[model samples]
Target: MGFDEKAQNKAQEFQGKAKEFVGDKTGDENLQADGAADQAESGAKKAAENVKDAAKNLKDGLTGN
Candidate 1:
């Protein structure tokens, strides 16, 4: 919902992508799984933030913010 949170999520997603790439190249299944999990977690967090933002927007609109 904020710049800092968005930046952190983007960083985490990027890190996950790098890990996944390295794991695939080196044939490390565990690392690959970890990377996938990280990506999923980032995605979930982003989604939650989006929902919160939408709710806030709706409330603000109703209250004439």
Candidate 2:
């Protein structure tokens, strides 16, 4: 299957971890910052997906789906 929002966000989080690890090993401040930003963005995306899913569930419940 194509990447869903959850999968995309999870992949992004793993990528951030890899970057952070590389930055730490290489002593690259910019890379570290970028990795942190990526992680934050991933977290935000996950939160948004959660909200959307919750909304959909609520709507479905109300509509007897």
The segments of candidate 2 whose C-alpha lies over 4 angstroms from its true place after superposition are 1-5
Best by TM-score: 1
Clashes of 2: 0
Tens-digit lDDT track of model 1 for 1-65: 67997899999999999889999999999889888988999999989988998999999999999
Weakest lDDT window of 10 consecutive positions for candidate 1: 1-10
TM-score of 2: 0.80
Candidate 2 overall lDDT versus native = 0.86
Candidate 1, which segments miss by more than 4 Å at Cα? none
Candidate 2 positional error at 28, Å? 1.0
Q: Rate the local accuracy (lDDT) of all candidates.
A: 0.92, 0.86
